[model samples]
Target: MAIPKRFEESFADITALATRFGENEAAYLSSKYQEAEVRQDFLDKFWLALGWDIYHQEHPNPYEREVKIEKSVMVGDRGKRADYAFYTAPNFLQARFMAEAKKPSRQLENQYDCFQAMRYGWNSNTPLAVLTDFEQFIVLDSRYKPTVERSLSGILEKFHYTEFGDEEAFRKLYYLFSRESVGNNSLEKYVEGLKKAKGKKTAKAAPAVQIQPVGDTFLSELDVHRENLARAFKRSNNELDGEELTEITQRTLDRLVFIRFLEDKLVEPSDIIDRLGKKSGSPWRDFANEIPRLNQVYNGIIFKPHAILDSPNFAPNNKTFDEVLAWLSHKNSAYDFNSIPIHILGSIYERFLGKTIIVSDKRAKVEEKPEVRKAGGVYYTPEYIVRYIVENTIGKLVEGKTPDEIAKMRFADIACGSGSFLLGIFDYLIKYHVDWYSGGARTLLSARLRSSA
Candidate 1:
């Protein structure tokens, strides 16, 4: 197959990348090529040159162009992982192809490498798979079952980075693995053609691999929760304006999640939300009454609520509140809030909470907050950005300090919306303090609290 006329731009980019790598070969081979992180970085640049969006921030709906890294696929009781999974569309219902990467020191054509790549492809049910280490790329036919006895002989084609300088070799690479070729089903077709040329009857392709689901994407679940709670709260209380209803709903979700987190962390007894579950009776009513007592017992220590029991939002008649409670409880979802990363939770809230409900003509309508939309539509400051800011400021200030000494330092964020920056700093301190004290710091911190008491 010939390279398309449109390949001119990509060809230039590939040439430039090859030249750059060739010039830095000595330093890279000695150090960077052996390190997993450094090799991953180079792979990102390599794909970027081939038109994949490595950062995933350029597109309006980043999922369309996103190259998901370290995508987990459960092989059995344990999870197996691939370095990159290329989805043709954003919903990730089907993976068009999969790519497994290795350190530059590893040979892409090695039997073990081929076996590993084939396993991921077969598990994912992708028709085409690529194994690469920035230096060598081997595209394989994953539709056939790959066996341990003969792994290296099952490949379609292999190419070296040095070969990109040869027009014929570059054309072969473009035909088998270019973004356009993969997107348009050309690569699958090429694999099929190779089988036909070898006088092999086209075996019916195996069923698409039922790859493990990504486990209820956090943002999708959060969005559904937000919409349902807003609707339920409004249905239960008709007198409140849209803004009031939104505030009440947001606060309710936040408080419940916060308590759930505490329970998971062992800071609170497990199953605090379970106290609300009932087979028959006014469970919501009972739950509402218990909040005041709870506030009296643990208010300032955990969180202080503003008369939650008195609000119509907490009324037992709002049976939908039971649904929300059940959703947050362990029986309804697999999420273990204790172990789930805090940044994932923070980012979801940051994005979903940027919209407010408006009551007009006695009907509620949800829209993005005007100021937030004007500023750029509720984009969560990516974790890397927050990391950079916090490391330079808070990290530098707190270094070489004790937990007690750190306690004396006061910090403020004037524009702490969903508190991603502040939350990051809090997480940082928690980790640093725990590391500093190792085994006994929690005991000490608890004692310090008791002394203050």
Candidate 2:
């Protein structure tokens, strides 16, 4: 159903859509409506979508039947099954038009439409006959008495705005069909707005959409984290100015999200941290151990940095900030700069993580690392997949980390196979740089990155 173009000014006042068969609707409704369980369900959805109810008087000729027009041109041909034939007086008005409803998959074409609808409408003395495949509804009307030609279908016809299979039909029907109705224009505009809103516009994720407070404690922590971040950036980047740095920090906090892969559990800081420390010993310990190993191999760098300024990337002023930012950018530009958030490691080794794969490889040729299991199986963790997981999980990852925190971020697969995780080592390294260079404002910086995504 192509949307009707209601006169913008009057659209609000009339609140009705302009209903046209061919110019607006790309397709028409089919008249053959028969009862088959599958067809009924399909038609039911179609009927409701088109604003016609079973209880209404102008309902299609039959409840459900796959009927062939008894006497018509296309006789002896197969007919489509439908739930109802509906007509409305106008837009949201009386049954001025009649239609036959069918399941969504039926395409309106040279089938039983002419044969069935002409006979049905001729017998009922109705002005319009319909053929519809829930997505696209067709409208067939009498040219003289018995002659209703093909109106809307295919291309080359000037009347192009016809959309019978979409939400646009309702908009048109209200405006065109009910010229006398009040607020016709308003309804049309409303429908248009609905369609527009429904359209895939660049919906800037509502300021990184703060989820409802699961608990005040987390909220408090989040707030403190953000505030501290703002202060840190303001303190470090005096060149960028206070307000600008503060703004960046706030944005970073907003983007902060804590995600957990576990099913049926509210993600909490303790989960990741606990798991990381629980080396088989403890999962958390295993993860912690894993991070350093990965860091050494992928980034050729180690953080286990206890001192705030121990890492050369840390900056307190202009000279240091420039160097830090440069290093950050350079590291990220590399093919394998796994950027792990600094605070994330200390907050909880469990979150903001880059994981290794534990699968068997097909060839089993390479020397298997500690975390990699090797045998006979297609178990190579592709870099793209690992990168996607870490980037996607960043939201939840930040929830557990804090500034001035750098613990060994690691991912250990108890059944490490082909070391699919090693592929993501670059991500872990880059995250480390990003978190440090962000000036403790992971939330805001993350937002800028996500918007580009």
- Which structure among the candidates has the greatest lDDT? 1
User: Candidate 1 residues 150-221, lDDT tens each?
Assistant: 667658787888987787888777766666777778766886676576545435554243222212254555
Q: Judged by TM-score, which candidate is best?
A: 1
| Candidate 2, lDDT over the whole model | 0.34
lDDT of each: 0.64, 0.34
- Residues 98-171, candidate 2: write the lDDT tens digits: 34544333554553444344334322333445554434445554211232233232111111123432345445
Q: Which 10 consecutive positions of candidate 1 have the poorest summed lDDT?
A: 207-216
Q: Report RMSD for candidate 2.
A: 28.4
Which segments of model 2 are wrong by more than 4 Å? 1-39, 49-51, 56-95, 102-107, 147-169, 174-453
- Which residues of candidate 1, in runs, are more than 4 Å off? 1-216, 275-280, 300-319, 397-409, 426-453
